[model samples]
Target: MSETIHTGGCQCGAVRFKAHGDEFASSICHCRMCQKQTGGYFGAFATFADNKVEWSRGEVSYFVSSNIAKRGFCKDCGTPLTYEWHGDGVSLAIGAFDDPDKVAPNKQLATKSRIQSFDTLHKLKVREDTYGVEQSCVKLQNFQHPDHDTTTWPKE
Candidate 1:
């Protein structure tokens, strides 16, 4: 069978990568460090072998988050991209993937640090943002990079 190829990058399209082979695993981390890095309640990631990843566009900037690990992100857009734990394979942020639905997280980590509100998030009431607003008056322009790879960014 052919190998599975996973493509992903930072929000600004400054850093792109292609991961070869099947993903080793997928998980959502609720550790405090993860929450801080992602600026969210938790971080979802898909693990892959180091050798299988290739930086196709730009290099990733890293922060030494701790003695055991470092976090990778885009310097231009500050998009959290990877979590590299010492001696462990790289884990790419699930939201950064070109097709995030492809990598469904099968496990949760650091549950002790999970926010209590997270469990009730689904039960919260949902409402459309345009409830009383005029749809035509709301002119939305998306500046964020597209979900697929692009030859050039910012359309210069």
Candidate 2:
């Protein structure tokens, strides 16, 4: 992969981070722990050197998911941040990244007990956007941080 700098954080912008290296590997995992952490069918991640990443804003709380692994997440908003394995190195949450569209999972892991309906999820029905819904939803302020760097976050 080409060299790049990746930045992102929790939904409330309480915890921001930046990784200064390209991903060594990107994968989707279907383990139960991953499912619980992400609240999704699977968790997508990009592995990077742990030393190359830094928390720019706030710190994450680490949960010892196993003897050899730990999960990091935002303490304020409960946003999953990182999953680190002793032997496998650091894995950054793909969904938590600023430009999630650019982070693609090239491999899959821990698929023995994968969610059965996950493959067909895209085939499921979705509500089409109605005319006034977007306008109405936007009338209230969006407290979530924008998908870009900011000098300060969550303005008081």
Candidate 3:
């Protein structure tokens, strides 16, 4: 495991935070709720131990996205930031950091909702299950295919 890494804030620099410990699970979620919350085709998250995270710059505003989960964002820019689950620790948005490359997504969840346009972004092919566990693709380029295989994802 890599040593804990510190990440910088958003565009205005009002929100700075640190994530300690190796990122355990990283994923892209294409669920409708995630799409609505993030205003994107999918939401990317990196999980970390609750005790390992420290907010250094700004306080986060939260929305109770579910009975057991709360979604956090920067109060200043409204950047969809973190997802906190009671007793489960936190998941931070990969795009909110200064360097998202430090972490790699282990799988993709709710792939059924993945945008079709994503398939064309790169030539990389993805080997995935319906559960969205991608065994082959590593870089973001793989998500460019508009015709991604979503067979393993749960159906509505």
Best by TM-score: 1
Tell me the lDDT of model 3 at 99.
72
C-alpha TM-scores of all predictions: 0.92, 0.90, 0.71
Model 3: per-residue lDDT, tens digit, 1-156? 667674744444456678877756788888887788789888888888888788876688899989988888878677788878888678888887667877667788988778888778687778564554454344435312112223222232
Among the numbered candidates, top lDDT falls to: 1
Tens-digit lDDT string for candidate 1 (1-156): 899888999988999999888757999999999999999999999998889888989999999999999999999999999999877589999999999888879999999999999999999988857764576647766678888888998778
lDDT of each: 0.91, 0.87, 0.72
By TM-score, the better pick of 1 and 2 is 1
Q: Which regions of candidate 3 deviate over 4 angstroms?
A: 123-156
What lDDT tens digits, residue by residue, belong to model 2 across residues 1-156?
A: 766888889899999988777646889999999999899988899877877788899898999999989999999999899999887467889988999867789988999969999889999999786989878988988788887778888776
Using lDDT as the yardstick, the better of models 1 and 3 is 1
Model 2's lDDT to the true fold?
0.87
What is the overall TM-score of model 1 with all chains considered together?
0.92
Candidates, ranked, TM-score: 1, 2, 3
Q: What is the lDDT of residue 153 in candidate 3?
A: 21
| Candidate that beats the other on lDDT, 1 or 2, i.e. the better one | 1
Better structure of 2 and 3 per TM-score = 2
Residue pairs with clashing backbones, model 2: none
